[model samples]
Target: MKQKVAVLGAGSWGTALAKTLVENGHDVMIWGNHEKQIDEINEHHTNTHYLPDVKLPEALKGTLDLAACIADADAVLFVVPTKATREVAAKFAAVCQNKPVVIHASKGLEKDTHKRISVVLAEEIPADKRQDIVVLSGPSHAEEVAVRDVTTITAASENLASAEYVQSLFSNEYFRIYTNQDVIGVETGAALKNIIALGAGALHGLGFGDNAKAAIMTRGLAEISRLGVAMGADPLTFIGLSGVGDLIVTCTSVHSRNWRAGDLLGKGHKLDGILENMGMIVEGVSTTRAAYELAQEMGIEMPITQAIYDVLYNDVDVDDAIRAIMLRDYKSEQEFTFN
Candidate 1:
């Protein structure tokens, strides 16, 4: 069935997803706060700043009015940044009268609350205006996904039907969607991988070879699984798409903002300077702090996340922080192995 979908946020991911939805024969109305970007999408069918060199689907429309976008929409896809999710959801709830399936593609924890994106949406959107929230995450990058690369992602929700619904909506020859019921595992893996990407990028910037990068990726997955399992997620979920799949892609790909940010930091650039230069939201920079604090509260040992946290926020030298990690007490790497 042809559905009217509202894609909130005009960033690269949002534009790319909106275009994909259009290609799937859905009427996609993308809503953004910036009138200029909305006009660009409508008039030029291009979002040059975010998805440069990619032509948007001409049938896709853009809107500045939130109400118009939400009116009679069958589904609302929240593609805004992590920081703006709560605020945007609250606004979405205020204007939306219908109970559409709520799905978020963002991958990060809320700064102060340290809550996952699903939790934030559940709290912000009233039950009357929303359905069970769904999370869409995996190894897909907007730049690659925009061009229809063979990208695979997972649609996870507490309800299997909801997840399957999303899987059916997004699956195409180039873009495949797998359904998983482990929301906690999927969200945790998706959010925490950015921190490791920072570490991976740092390793790259510090003149480390593939051996060092491999070490970070391996140990990083361990820490991510440790913290994820501690937070009530299934340990095996880390091996799936949102877990190892996302970690490998984000930590190694040039399309990763988190890796790029970490690369700049590893090259001795300040956080503020890197953010300014990147002109994009580097989720790992903020995720490091959240994961660091959450680990402390949960009594989970995440040394890698802590090391990146200190480098990003504590003003510690990257080399010194790395040395501190390397010098930590060593034990069996298979301590958490499935026996």
Candidate 2:
């Protein structure tokens, strides 16, 4: 079914998704704050700043007017950064009238509240203005997806129908979508994996070998699964696309902002300097702090997250943090046996 989809970000992911929707025969409009970028997208059909060298579909449009972009849209997809989510959602709620199946592709927990993006959306958007929230997440990178590379992701929602609805909108020859009912697991895995990606990049920058990288990734999954299960997520979801799949790609890919940020940090660069140089939002940097706080508050043992948090927040050296992690009391490799 053809639908008018409003994409609430002009970043690489937003433009890529908007392009996909347009190609899929849906009416898509991307809302961006920058007039220059919006004009570029509308007039030139390109978003060079984010997805350089990639040409967007001419059918896809961009608008500076948020209200105009979302007006009469069948669905609203929020792809903005975590910090900007609430502000954008509130604005959408104020202007939106009809109920749209709200979808978010952004991954990260709220800084202080430690809430998932879906939870943040639910809080800011009034029930009368929106339907069930769906989270689209996996190993898909904007650069790859923009080029029509084969990619698969999970569209997760507690409302199964909504998840399937989202899956229909995004599934195509190059982009495939799977529906999952475990919104909590999907969202948490999506957010927490960025933290591990940071550690992975740090390991790389610190001159560690493949063995160290493998250890961080494997142990990182354990930490993610532990906290995720404690927070009421399904244990099996950890092995699915949003968990291991997302973790592997984010940790290993050069396209990951979190990994790049962590690489700089591992090289002994200051957080502020690294962020300023990156010219993009590194979700892991903020996620490390949130996860650290959440783990401490919940009494969950997430040592890797704590180590990354210390390096980012407490001015602890990356080497010292790594050493501390390695020197921690050893225990059974498997915390619990699977039947």
Task: State the lDDT of candidate 2 residue by residue for 1-339, as single tens digits.
Answer: 999999999999999999999989999999999999999998998999999999888889899999999999899999999999999999999999799999999999998999999999999999999999999999989999999999999999998999999999988999999999998999999999999999999998888989998999999999999999999999999999999999999999899989888888888888899999888899998999999999999989998999999888888999999999989887888773120
Candidate 2: where is the Cα deviation over 4 Å?
336-339
lDDT of each: 0.91, 0.92
What is candidate 2's TM-score against the reference? 0.98
Q: For each candidate, give its TM-score against the true structure.
A: 0.98, 0.98
Candidate 2 weakest lDDT stretch, 10 residues: 330-339
Sliding window of 10 residues with minimal summed lDDT for model 1: 330-339
| Residue-by-residue lDDT tens digits, candidate 1, 204-225 | 9999999989989989999988
> What lDDT score goes with residue 187 in model 2?
94
